[model samples]
Each structure stands twice: as structure tokens, then as C-alpha cells.
Target: MAKSTLTPELAARFASIALGHVRREYPNKPDHTLAGPQDAQTPSQLHPVFYGSYDWHSCVHSYWMLARLLRLFPDLPVAADIRALFDEQFVAEKIAVECAYLAAPTARGFKRPYGWGWLLKLAEELALHDDRRWSERLRPLAEIFAQRFRDFLPLATYPVRVGTHFNTAFGLRMAMDYAVVTDDRDLAALLGETGRRWYGADADCPAWGEPSGDDFQSSALIEAECMRRLLPAEEFLPWFDRFLPRIAQREPATLFRPATVTDRSDGKIAHLDGLNLSRAWCWRSIASALPECDARRAIAEETADRHLAAGMPRIAGDYMGEHWLASFAVLALEA
Candidate 1:
């Protein structure tokens, strides 16, 4: 397959805005170190979403963005700094475990895991670059993930399906990546079955009833990628060709709509607006999977250009929304 070319103008713009946001928001540190006043602010302080604060899922997503930037513009000094920030702030063993397995935060705020699959997916990318130490460190988390899949198998018997989006998606991604690394057929089979049962025959649409916007699109992309690796090209190609365009067209509005104000009983309008970049990350997955497809190619190019121009701060609050920035950067750079 031919590589996609990265436009110099776009690269500079994305790197500059991303770096500038990091510098301004995290002043006094080259990497994303949080302390003092920055840490004291509410979760909404960082983004429009109330669940952004203390959500490890969001933190991992931002790390994905940084990792992509590092891969795309490795020669840039800012890339090195962003890499350091990811190492220091995002990529930790305990952090991964907490976000992937724990359940305490759902009671405190939103019930979503914000896009944790991207973290494991990013870990796989880092491992491919010969960073075996981190990859090895990430293996146990995959094991924990495997066990979770075992527990969630009986869709009808499972206690609740509505809130398991992050869990199910992360579990499938980690299990498939784990199978690749360890050559475990059991894990692969488990992942394949889960994908088939929940994501349709080709894993094109929602499998377990109706899923939210992020869950539906992101899970489809992850399932499709995993199945592509395991199934014959002929078996998966038709579905990939059919679904990529639909996802490309539907994702924008599902993700970037302005927050609507809701009337509270106390006669106050609650302002609700923020960009959730997970859709962008899903687009990145689609782009990565079918780089040759025309519609997906155009969507990936246009979305990356828009993000580079937006200059939104890429942090935990913006993690779910902006995690795609890195995946897009890697796609563009490698293209």
C-alpha cells in the first residue's frame, strides 16, 4: 500500500498549538506535571464535561495524542518534551490498572471510562517501537482484561450492559493485542466471539442492543481492526468497505456538537458544551485500518486539519475528545 503524505504546513500547525496548550496550561514544566492551583480546580475547569476531572481514562487518551505527536515529528524538540510528559504523567502501571479495572469513579461522576482502549492500543504501538520494558509492564493489565472478558461473556446474564462501553471496548482491544504479542489462540477466539456477538457479523454495527454514539462507532472500529488481523482479507474487506464511510459521515455530529443548556429546577440554565475527541480517535482507527479507502482518507485528512487549527488544550478534561490527535498524527506522518 502507498503511504499517505503529511503536509508540512499541517504538521507545524498541530505541533505548535498542542505544544502551546501544554506550555500555557502546565506552565513551569516542560512535561504535563500537575501541582498547586491546577490540581485544585474542579474537573470542569479543564473542559466542559464534569467527568473530565480525576478520570484516568481521559488522562490516558491525552497521552495517546502526545505519543502520536512524538511519532510524527520526532525531530522536533517539543515532541521529546511531550514524550517525557507521557512517560511521567500518563504511562504508569498503577494508573492503567485503576482506569481499566476499578469502579469507584462511576459513583463520583460519569459512569463512562472515557476511551481507555486507546491507552492499550497506544501501548501496543509503543511496544512495536521496541519499548519492550513498557510492553512487558503492560502485560499484566491485559491479563486482568482477559479475566474481565470472561466475566462479561453471557450478554443476557450479565448484570447490566449499558455502562460497560469502556470496559467491553478496552477488554476486546487488550485481548486482541495480547493475543498478537503472546500468540494465544484462546484469547483471540474469545475476542472474536465477543466481537461477533456484540458488534454484528462483520462487527459493523451495535451488537448488544443500542449503544451510545462513542460506544457504537469506537467499538465497531476496534472490532473491525481485530477481526481484520484474524480473519481472511476477503471475509472482512466487504464489511470494512461498507462501514467506513458510514462511520466517517456520522461521527462529526455525534461528537462535536455544542453543549445545550438544561433548565434546573432552581431556575438556572446549566451550560453543557465540550468536544469529546474519542470520535476523532475512532476515525483514526478507521483510517489506520483502511488507509486506501477514499472516503475514509478524505475524512481523516479533513479532521486532522480541523483539530490542528482548533488549538484546544489536550489534557484529561479533553482526553476523550482529543486522544485521536496522536493517532491522526501517526497516520498522517506515516502516510
Candidate 2:
């Protein structure tokens, strides 16, 4: 099969999937902490802008995907709808309330690294658009997460090496994209330093614990992708060598294979679909860093194609996977 690329047709399809749910507030799974009866509020009441797509983080990244689609395919028929939605949702008052929610004492670790990283990524994408309205309105909320990273990374001496939302490497990788775009040199330096500190010495990753029941990421591949983004080419190449030295031979055979998803309707089991897509993202990115003649380059390219083939077909189906799979599909195809 041919590699799955993000054409305008695919962008529109993804946009339609996101637009269908980003505002559908029902069937919500909130990552909320209710302090009392007074704190009992609907998802829309608490998170006006991000109250759909099953949960807050899913909503946030779905917005990110929509913003990205708008930027990449501005002439798509859905572009006007996306712009109108952003105008309606990213107003100053609503954003201020969202910022206040993040500042609440009870929400100190509400979404932690995962949601925090994605929020910054949304901020990054919004800034790319010609209109400055959305990015400016969202800046305060983004800054709160940026500051959260500044305060949290120092205390986080160890990395969460899981293929799930809490994975520290995935958080760092996404946040680094924002830091670079915003030219926050201090934040950039801090993220790079924290990445090296946590993963610099990680050699010969056995990848023994991948495809865990609820994992949506590949811990081993994401770590390499993280290093590729955080460190310079000369530095990351050697690190990649020590990290997954047998890529050419595919010794850690699991990394080359796409994960199987038996049931897309089961939320956690559905994560395997995301795992496949995200692996494609990582493989494509990691391959770009390799020289043309390198033996691993071809292997990485082929594996990415296999993963994309497996994952793209399942981007939309049951609500469990449909709520968020398109975002990972965007990452894989765009990468």
C-alpha cells in the first residue's frame, strides 16, 4: 500500500470528525477534582472552550488538530467553519476562566504533563495562523502551562517511561515544539536540559514493556524522537545509536510491528490504534534524521508505512477511538 499522506481530502475528513465532537458536550469524562457541592458543574460550565470529545485533553488536541488543518489547508471548504469556531471559542473572557481553573489549588496537577504539553502545542499552532486573535487570547492559559513546566521539571528527577499520557518523554517532546516556535529561549534551554538529564544516559532500551493494555504511545520511539527534537543532530545521532543500536537488524522486533486493536469501542483497548499512529509519527521523524545511505533509514521508512497503513483505517469508527484517534493520525501523516 502507498504511504498515507495528509492531502486536503484527508484534512477535511479529519476536520469533520473533530468539528463533530469538539462541541458535543455529552458523554463526557472529566478529569476534574470537585472540592465540594458548589464545585459540581457541567463540563461546559467549567471548561467552556474544551468540554467535549470525551475529556479535556482529547478536546484540547482535537482543537490542535483543527488549528493545524486550517493552517495546512486554508482553502478547504471547512476552513471557514474552523475559523468561526475559533473566534467563538477563543474569546478573552472564556480563556480567562480556563486560566483561573488551572490556577485553582485543587487543579495543581489536573492534567499534568500530557495536557500541559498539548495546550502549549495548541498555542504554537494558533500563533502560526495569520490572525493573531486566537493566539493572543490563549496566551495566558499557555503561559500558565509553560510556567508549570518550569516549576515541575526541576522537581521531576525521573521520567515516566510509559506508553501513556503520563509519559514524561512525550510531554517534553510536545512542549519543545512550542518552546521553539515561541522563541522562549529560557523555556527551550530548560526543556533541553531536563530532557538530557532524564534520558541522556538511557542506553540500549529493551522495549520490553511496550503495547501495554492502555498505552497510546511507544515509550522507546518517543524517547528517541524527544532526543531528536531536543538535542542537536550530532549529539542525537550518537544517542540514537546507543539507544536502539539494532534498528537495522530490527532485533527489538516489536518496534517494527504495528500494534493490533481487537476492539475500537473499548476506550483503553482502543489506545492500541493510537499507539500504531504515534509509532508512525516517531518512525518518520527519526528516519528524517538519518542520512540517506544509512541502513536503518530504509527500515525506519518501511516500518512507518506499515504503521500508518494499520492505524489510518481506524481513525474514525466508534466514539471511543473516534474521539481522539485523528489527532495521532494527523501527527503521523504530517510528520
Candidate 3:
């Protein structure tokens, strides 16, 4: 298969859909949260709350989508609002510092932190925006993250083991961004070491296991991309190559599996299956990073379009659906 090409018309169309969806789907309140429509019954129906309450993960993911939209279409109305959310919801609350422990309490209750990386990445993005308010906001979080690195490293959760890499990478990325922003070499070096250790020995595993599917792949790739940005080209390139093939071969059905299993006695997939979007999004990210190779592009486009068209809602933090939109938009626009 030849690599699919993206025309301006197609790119515009995808961008339009992405922006429109974001505008229509996101709530209009100043709280900066996206709520499910009145008709929404299931968890997936809620725009941003698909993963639960709007926390750092969903907020950061929304920030990324908004940033991407701003990059492609600067005139979009939501850019300022998105920036404000980053400042108020994430930066103001100091979620990164207050919620630094891996076992912090969520809006629901005590839940393991699986998406700290996304939060740190958001901080990096905020730093790039170069606003003084954001700089003051992020410094304390960075310090707290630096101090609490060891506390977060050893917690046992499914993705925490492999996923911590993403958090660590973001922490380092934020540290670097903060360093540049504040011109503090000490902060830079500290964050640099944090990134190095996260990508180095802390995140490595004896078994480079195949991801469960696209969502898992997407989650992994987010961390992988962070690593690529922070680490030397040689150290992480092999990791990318090793997993690219598996990501290319991922199937759409893998994403629809239940999110949690209830009973060992009954060998059936659980209802929570639809919630796992991180893997799918990670797979899309991996595909986007390839060199526009024929097979790679086909998989990327087909996978992205098929998933989006298959009733995947564009909710924040719903990694499966969000990544489907994000990856496709990136490939189409960048093509």
C-alpha cells in the first residue's frame, strides 16, 4: 500500500470537525469542564467525564487538544478558554503538587494515579505559553514533583509500572521548560536528572510486553514521545522501532473491550470495556511518528478513520476516543 496523502480540503475538514466537536461538546460554563448532554445515560456519553470527574488528566488532555487546534487554526474561539482552564483548574489548584502521591484521592475516592504524565505534559505546554502567572503557578508543582519522585515510582498498578515513564518524562519536560522559562540552571538540572532516570532505569522493564490494544499503545506512545523529546536519539530510538510493528498491527475491536472485570467465575468481558481509550490513542500516536511510509500511513489513516466513524465520542481523557480524534487530526493535518 502506498502512503495516503492528505489534501488541504481533507485537513480542513478534519480540523473543522475537531474544532466543532470541541466547541459543541465542551460545556459553556467558566468552570472549564465538559459535561455529558442531558440525554447522556452511560459514562461514555459524558463529554469529558467519561473517565470520571474532571481532574488533571482530563484537563490536560483537553489542553493538548486545544493546543493542537490552536496550532492548526489560530482563530478558533476556544483557545483562550483552554488556556484559562490550564491556569485555573490545573495550575491554580496545584494538582501536580497536592496530588503528587500515586495513591491520591480522586473526586470519586482513593484511586491510583495512572495519568500523571499527562498533567506534567500540560505544565510543559503552559510553560511554553510564557505567561508570568503560569510560571509562578508551575514552579511550586515542579518542586513538589521533584521531591516526591521516589514516592510515585514503586506503586503497583497495571499501567503505573510502564506508565510512570510518561509521568516522569513530563516532570522532566516541565522541569526543563521551567528552567528555560526562569533561567534557573539548578531547576533545569534537577528536572533533567528526573527525566533521565524516568526514561533510564526507572521505567525499563525486563519484558517489553505487547500492549493489549490501540488504547494501551496510545498511552504508551504518549510516554514514549515524551521520552524521545527528553532523551538522546540513540537511547530511545530502539524502543520506538521495537513497538512500531505491533502498533501497526492493532485491530479496532481491541478497543471496545470492557474496562474492568467483575468476576473470575464468569469468563466474560465487563461493561467497563468501552472506557479504555488510552491504548488506542497511544497506537495512533505511534503511527503518526512514522516516516510516512506506505504501510504505516495506511494503518494510521484507516485505523483513525475507522475508529472515529465507529461511534467513538470525542470526550476528554477518554483516551480511546480522544486519541482516535487526536491521532487522525495530527496525521491528516501533517500529511
Candidate 4:
């Protein structure tokens, strides 16, 4: 099936697009939970290093997107610029400031699992660089999130199966990547256990109701993706068959098609664009885990392309969407 490609040019375009926002503190759209007097300060004052790209979570992931692109295409035209930005932002003092914000009583559960996961994912990408310096500097924050996962997963009685920021599957999947790269045995084991506990028995998921106006992730697909990571193919295949049964028939219908965004200006509605891109990665990931001869493989790839087509073009026009959409677009195309 045909698909959108993440070529060198596109990587450069995406990197450039993302660089514009990761540090653009103004016109911010922070999701802060201010409680005391000090909490009323601006986002940058609180999150010193990550107060841009509309909100903390978006800024975290956008940094991940840039780190990933540079690693993939080290010779990108904007390579020097990328390195410069990292040098400027990944300082020990800056990271400490970002860490301090988490200490605020009002910021206790600041970004929770969503932003928590992205920060770890960013650290994982930095690990791939030949230099271990950035990864080490990033570890303090990554460790915090890693510990958060270890502490929270078991207490999270029901998995958040939403297609929004708080989605547990998305958090687990990304955090799992960090654990694997850093060899965090405790974090890795906890993730696996919690994932299975929450999703091991799930099956026949009805995914017809999806792409809610503010959805940027697919609850059904992401849950399946998490299961894929934790289980061997032998176990995962049967589980997947039961979870998304009748894929060959496209029974859920919504799972096979791209969602339409009625308005890009509305930041909430623009999440549909992110939904398409994120769904594409989830489809690609799901397809990779399926048996080679499985009919779902072809459908997965085809629909991934359809979703990519639906979101890739609109990733940068509106600042509302532009703030974070490119990160998801990169994931879909790279997947």
C-alpha cells in the first residue's frame, strides 16, 4: 500500500517546524493546576525549560520528535541548529528548574502519566546518541518519571482507556521504551505486570465510537499495542484476534477509516488531526506484531496510510495544531 514517507527533506521540515515552538514561550496554552500564590506565575517561570509548544506535554513530545529526527537523519540540513538548541536547553541548571516545578505541592501530579511518559521517551531517544552526556543530564528527570510509573501503575485500578492525554496504554507503551533502553528492570517489570493486569483479559473491543473531537490517541489500538509489547507473538496473536475480532470484516468500521477534522482553529477539534497520526502509528505497530499471513496486516498498513494522509498535510498550518501535531505526524510516518 502507498504511504507518506519521512524523507530527509520531510525530516528537515518537521525538525524546523518543531524548533519554532519548543521555546516559543508566549501565546502559551499551559494546563497548569495552580493552587498557591506562587503557582499563579507564567508557565515558563514554573517549567523553565519546557514551558513552550502550547503546554508542557506538547513541549516534551516535540523535543522527543526533534531528538528522534536528528538521530534518524544526523546529516539533516538543520543538524547544527538542532545541536545548538539541545545545547541551549538541555543544561543541568535548566533541567533542575524543570524538576523543581514538580516539587510544588500544587504540581504533585503535574503531567501525570502522559507528560511523564513523554519525558522518559525523550530521554530514551537521547540515549541513542553516541554521546551519553545528554542522556545522563536528562536522567534526573527521566528517573523521576520512571519512578512515577513504578509507583502509579499498580494503584491505577482500571486502565485509562481513553483516546486522550491521560490514556494509560499510550503512557505504558512509551514508558516501556524508556525502561528497555535504560535497562530499568524495576520499571520494566512493573510496566509489564500492570499492563497485563489491566488488559490481559480484555477482548472483542468495540471501537466504533472514536475520534472524539479532542482525541489524539486511540484507546483500542493503543491497548492492543501495549499487549503486543508485553507478550510474545504466540500469546499476542490470539489475544489480538480476540481483542479486535473481525478485523477482516472491518466490523468496528471506525478503525478502518480516517477521522475528519471539522475545524483546525479549535485546538480541541484539531486533536482529530493528532488522532489520525497517532492511530497510524498504532496501526503500523499492530501490523508489525501480527502474523505475516494475517489478513489484518494488509488492512493495518492500508488504514495507516489513510490516517497518515488525513493528518500529515494539516500538521503545521494552524498554531493550535502546529504546537504539537508534527510530533505525532513524525511518529506515524516513521512507523
Using lDDT as the measure, the top candidate is: 2
Q: Between the candidate structures 2 and 4, which one is better when assessed by TM-score?
A: 2
**Per-model TM against the reference:** 0.52, 0.99, 0.47, 0.97
Error of 2 at 110 (Å): 1.2
- Stretches of candidate 1 exceeding 4 Å from the true structure: 1-54, 90-116, 137-142, 154-175, 181-184, 200-230, 238-335
lDDT of each: 0.43, 0.93, 0.41, 0.86
Q: How accurate is candidate 1 locally (lDDT)?
A: 0.43
For every candidate in turn, the CA RMSD to the true structure comes to: 9.3, 0.8, 9.8, 1.2
Ranking by TM-score: 2, 4, 1, 3
CA error at residue 270 for candidate 1, angstroms? 15
- Measured by TM-score, how close is model 3 to the native structure? 0.47
Residue 195, candidate 2: alpha-carbon lDDT: 91
Q: Which 10-residue window in model 4 sums to the lowest lDDT? A: 101-110
Q: Which candidate tops TM-score? A: 2
Query: In candidate 1, what residue range of length 10 has the lowest lDDT sum?
Result: 266-275
Residue range 1-335, candidate 2, lDDT tens digits = 56678999999999999999999998999988988898899999999999999999999999999999999999989999999999999999999889889877899998988999999999999999899999999999999999999999999989999898899998899999999999999999999999999999989989998878898999999999999999999999999999999997896999988898888888999999999999999999999999999999989989999999999889897999999999999999978
Model 4, 175-203: lDDT tens digits are: 98899998888888888888889999998
